[model samples]
Target: MWCFDNQKLHMNMAILETQSEGGNIRDSLLLTCQSSSNLIFGIQPKQEPLIRSLSESELRQMPKERFNQNEFSSIKLSKDLKIRKEDIILYNRESGILRDSLEKDELLTKSEKERRKTNREKFKRALRVERLHFLLPKKEKNLKPQPALKIDWSKSKIKTNPDIIKVLKSFYTNRRDPQFPTGNQKLLLEKLAPFPIFSVENNLRQIILAYPPETYMKNLSDKLYDYYYRLYEWESDTRATSIGFFFFNPEDALMYESTIWKYGSLSAAELGTRLSFFRFSTAYKLNRTSPPEIRFLFIPDVKEVGDLVTRYRYQYGKQMKFHPNQKITRDGFADQPIYTIENVQLKQGLFSRREVSYFGELKDHKYIFFTVDGAESAWNKFRQANPNLRLPRRPNLLVYNFNSFINDCEMDPDLINQNFIFMLNREAYKALDKSKQDTPKVSDFSIFIDNRVKPQLFLIKIWAKRLKLVLFHAPRINEFPRREALLDGLTNFFPPSLYRVK
Candidate 1:
């Protein structure tokens, strides 16, 4: 049944091809009907014309050039001439339809051609409108507005710590203290602006809470001391002495003493006694003499002290009165006399040097003057007299004054007496000036003081077994200690309330 149907379909295709190629449409239909009848009747069909398939080479060799009018007429005249089998098949399938359509159009009247062209344009317009309609709803859907995004404020909330809040509140409350100006409070807040306030507050609170009050207070005091210890004003000044006084109880002084020792020298701890003196003075309204008499003797040059009387007269002038010549006292076994200079009145009582002694009573006077060379000579003679008695070698200050000062103060007891304050005059300024020249950008003199002077002062303190005298070196002529510098130094250590001049 399938084979019969297939044969009948092929016969119909042949009839269509024949009609499309200019064969008689009626005759082709009759042939197809007869073939179908034969298939249905079970009669064997007659042999149809054999159509030979052309090779690819033969099909490619066919001429593709357009024909002129004469050539076209010739092609029409030879319409019945048989070409290659493939050519016939190709023309019957596709090219034949196109050729027939062209020939039919040529035969049409002008009015009929115009009518066909208009119909074709109308059909194209309808197809384009249908396509536009199909896409219009999709474009409108795309152009429609989307819903606005809804924000969740809760998700963007700022995180805060309770401890930080507590700390901030404490600072704010303290800011209202009568001691601090509102302007200063604002300035402090501005300084703190760059820091994460909450984070710092939280960390500080945690640290403070972690330690006991005593431990925490001590730690804070230590930190404050370490920060300011190198400043010349703080090294031996009364303000530095007063720092831990208000913060610590009298009973805790020993603890503070031990703690301070761990950080710096014994001299540094002794400086705290200045606070005691301040407390006494404030409470009693009278200066306390509990602090030893600190006498500053400025030696301009160490080499110029061969004859004490002669040098004193030359330096201070004849107007200055000196004590009558007296024999220097010595220990019972010593052959040489101990060096002493007494009662030298400068500028008619401007201020007087009551006595100058080498290895003698250093606490007996408020002022003393002695040359470094003279003191060394006296130390050598005294050492020779008592062979068993040991004395440390004298410090050499000629080459580097400041360095020598530090070394001697740390090593030599004679240099660091409780009652004696040694002031290196022009030599100190020269040394410091030279250092500055070598490195001009050092804005902080505290570094130099710490690295050079403080260690010697500390050594002197240990030798004296008491808070040694405060040493003041002249920075310029007639300006041994700058009062302004001292006050400014106080500002670094004390709260504004305490630093107020009484």
Candidate 2:
């Protein structure tokens, strides 16, 4: 079945090949796998014909030249597009006006003139707005002149100080929260425009990581995985909730903690108390914090089981339907008429189970989750082949203590208390224990899986733990389906080539 659209790249070539000689097709694939040094597998011999058919016999015979031609052509085309040498079409306001005046001398209808005038005004207005946004400062300041009635968008309650709004507005426009926008925060910001959840978690993650580098790294992984797992689970509970689903970045929590650290001089207990009050109160008034729309599943033809092999349908569903149990009805995705296949691979020798999972989606995108199967079960054989192998932990969330981090600063002895050192080690111990499963208590310090922006949060935990940061990320969904796909895809495609020496 060939999935074709007017769009060039949307051409999906599906070739279901049958062997002409019936010479064990599996052996051919196995031969290719061995000869190619495992660079090629998951690809059945049936799929090989598709590639072979695309190549000329001469090209196939001259593998070296063929490879070079493919590489050179691809690189040259991409480079040409990026650095195309062309004469610039310069347009000057004065020259355009002069040309228009000259054209008017030939002929001008009253309606045409009026339409042109209206268009000119509209263009000018748009230009004005663009310039205004461009000139706006990229960094947010704690202090800014505010309207007489200042209100924070997150919490609509009137406040004497309107600095938070100023901060948010800057972040919204610049895509950066200047104060605590570190490396992880920057990555979250980059992804926020495409996936709004990054913005939500940005502040929350910042606070958790501010604890201590060592502790945060240890516990952040599992806690982060648990966060998304819960949200995906929630999507299955009801469509209404799924419809209103949103995401936040983990770094935002860190940003929030940094703000408290920099501006407020209160103890950890006081800071936690103040934050809890502020969060609850603001949530009531402003309805400020909500997840962002990460992806949408618009299934126009889900009525046919066969049509389920489209990538676009899967992409939309992967973003929207977090839990496999959360069934998206055919009627739920009727709005978008045009559809394309987005994820059409297998996992464990079968198409992914209908169980809704964000990790499933990530994996589909990154890895070709395909395995061989036939009359005898392949899973048993594969397991027997690697009996001692164990799957790596999905990912973990780490929480850090802020009080401990500041104490390590070279000047901390003069400015802040060093008691945080002991607190951080204790928290780190609790987070790293594989046997511990207690929900974090709301004491002087608190940590939990950030439901929003779980992958970004998991990555942050990975980075922090590797660096021994004291932050605990709450466990969320194990792996975002898309993320797994991306990681494995890179691994499969980006391998080092081995040369045979004569």
Candidate 3:
């Protein structure tokens, strides 16, 4: 299936290959021991098609002889639109009239006029509020073009994990929270605008990788998969308590931990966390902290089956400048909307235990965001447009100690503690064993807190005796612990890359 959208490169391109010869992408897809893909095996062959939509006239006007990523460095309308003075005397009467007259009298070329008109329209809409909070989701953030890292299946491939396959077949059951907008507390509901989720046209599921390079998908993906298995859902725990569902496979808890230790390490998990934080820092647009419309799955277990194939159903509307590397999306995307589907079928293989997780709504997509000015009107339009589409009961995602994840009251800048309990890994158990010395009165072990600059090393306090790791300490280092006249600490490694402001 051709998954690339109407405009620019979409999704992780490498996971696919043109099947024009056989007329089947599945045949080209890796179908070896890996029953399914943790990450779609690889991208299609390099495509040379230019932005066929761009006119010869427009291409000539580009600043560089070639395309420029900064060409569309978003123009922030909110800043100029805000009104500060309580009294300006009709813009000082003369000043207002003179400014209006000068603007009306100025003559401009057709192209210039079109550009100005587009901006003016945005300005006019912003009149309803300060620069109409572009609240629209942003897809691209400026990133220097870098080549996509190529993956060769024959070299250093992840060995098949029979245990995980067995475990999923035996224990992984499908689960859903059926919750919606449950986590939208930071954002007020009255200000929200409900938009229908982006649909899969013609029932084809195309997974578009918007700006995959911007997040360094290759490097991130590299750290995710080991020689034996992939850490597809290492962050599953983070989402489990927030917006996502959690099912305790207690029957296989200890076994699962031991299995992971077979191939990966805690350091790998830390690197994964840093990469995630890096994505969080660089993935979103300036106006939004996170993507506004988060897709919280109704069926948690389905996603656990990260082994599904790729290619998605998508609607590409509007073109924007993107990364300027060698071959993909450099010239920009199509100006018109096109519905294209890149289908990668999920192979159920031998794990046909519907008794464990009978298929849920595997194709449904739900998305949401908030609007300040037209909340009522937006919902009214939504109600009239899609009467059949129902919203989940929860407004936003909810977390057990979600609030404690941050310092709302701004308490101790150094340490803000919360209630967290997790089973200690084998490393902690080993530390406990060491603490018990040869002395008969003492347990042979040592006590230590995993203060490694790890962004995801969740273990904060460890009780060697009970072998329980306590975590989630919101540390506010307004004054780094080693910042006084008496303490000038070692400098930050990546600095701020691992830290979150909120």
Candidate 4:
């Protein structure tokens, strides 16, 4: 058997070749034989074995440890490692070898990008829905239907109570007399008759003398008491030839005149005869107290009283004295200066003590005064101008030419003292708009008027203090009972005690 050590083969071969020249015939013979075998068989020299290259798929599946670093050093990491279509197109775009593949992958990558974008939008929408679900009230999501509301039409309407109507009718009818029948005589008789034949003339005299002097004399403050006593004493001593009597309602004047003529005496005995007539007729007309109150005036002479009666005309009436002495003044006047703004100037003349009048256009629309007379006049004028003009009521705060108010004031300054003074011009109101809408302070009206009228303003302030004039703003236009509310301020000035005569 031949022994072979492959590791020492090269050294043995070299030794054999070197020993060939120095004979060792067997070694030379062996070398010649190997050379002859190489020639004869056409055998080539042996070289190291070549490594097998892996395909792209095989490299991806190959274990990491099995990979040869030296063999893969020249290959790009992106090509050697598993690469997505998007990465291949992005990184290998410049390689002409991969141009076709990269172009094909471009479509896939675009679709993949769009798919991811769509998924992201869906996620955002879901998040928004979740957030809103947390914010909404649970009850709102399950709301139940509600029943319709109901109102009783009959109850809502202002139907007059039968009981109230019966009471009012009885009240008025009981006071009616048989001798002095009213327009509704049939109704009065049916409701109130089987009664006495009442004498109003005798009743008037009795009512006048019913109260003791103390009723009129007491409760008056020291200043008012002194004033009254002075007038009473003056009248008693001077037998003050004449006295001035002021009547608020024209009907009251008529009643007094008719009663005195019929009964032949100016006593309170006759009050009952015509009291109902006076009350019913003047109930809606006068804003002041009903059953015309009395205010006494003691003048130096009876002639002055006559002058006043004549000057007052419909508002005043006279009667002659049959006896040595008689009371001169009669029922109190309801004609308050404040209520009759237009009559203020004329009413000022009726004040024997002092004359006072406030004259100014209301500023802005802050204060509005609507008069029944003015509204009627405006409606009538409007109807005249356009015969077809229709309105529910007179238009409230109707704008009128300022000249009309100015002319009315100029013609009769007395009328300016009314509760409502129409502003003839917006410009004039703007001019007077400096004062605030509050109670007319002493300084407000006093400083506003001309220097010549300052004393009169002072006197007005003093009178208001004595009378306790309550201040109020008139109700807005369209307010129910606007006129009545405007008149309420003057009501405080006329107490029942002030109206009572001793």
Backbone clashes in each candidate structure, one number apiece?
Answer: 2, 116, 42, 36
What are the candidates' C-alpha RMSDs? 48.1, 29.0, 28.0, 53.9
The residue-by-residue lDDT of candidate 3 on 14-50, one tens digit each, is 1122323333321111111111212221323334322
Local distance difference test, each candidate: 0.28, 0.24, 0.22, 0.26
What is candidate 2's TM-score against the reference?
0.15
Compose the digit string of candidate 1's lDDT tens values, residues 1-502. Answer: 0011212212121322122233322111111212232332123567563343223343232212233332222122135643221111112222354555333567667876676556544433322211101100011123321111111111221122234554445444421132332333333333323311000001011100111112222345344433332221111221111111211122222233333323322223233321111121131111111121111111123123234334533444443332233222221111111223332222325564332123433445322222434445545665576454343344211211222332233444453232333322233334334434554453357656644576577656554542121244346555534433333344223111001001
| CA displacement after TM-score superposition, residue 41 of candidate 3 (Å) | 17
lDDT (Cα, tens digit) per residue for candidate 2, span 1-502: 0001111111111222223333312101100111211111122233231122222232222111111221122111122333111211112222343443423423556765566556444433322211101111111235321111111111211112324565455434422112343333333233222211111112223211112111222245434532433322212211111221111212222333334333322222121211111121222112222232112221111122223334324533432122222333553422212111122222444554332111222333311111011101322343345445432112111112111222233233332211111111121222224213433334332223333465366567555543332222323444223432223333222111111000
Off by over 4 Å in 3: 1-245, 252-259, 267-502
Say which prediction, candidate 2 or candidate 3, comes out ahead on lDDT: 2
lDDT ranking of the models: 1, 4, 2, 3
Give the TM-scores of the predictions, in the order they appear: 0.13, 0.15, 0.16, 0.15
What TM-score does structure 3 among the candidates reach? Answer: 0.16
lDDT of 4 by residue, 214-300 (tens): 222223343353343232211122111111223322233334434343332212211222211112122211211122112222111
TM-score order of candidates, best first?
Answer: 3, 2, 4, 1
What lDDT score is found at residue 119 in candidate 1?
A: 51
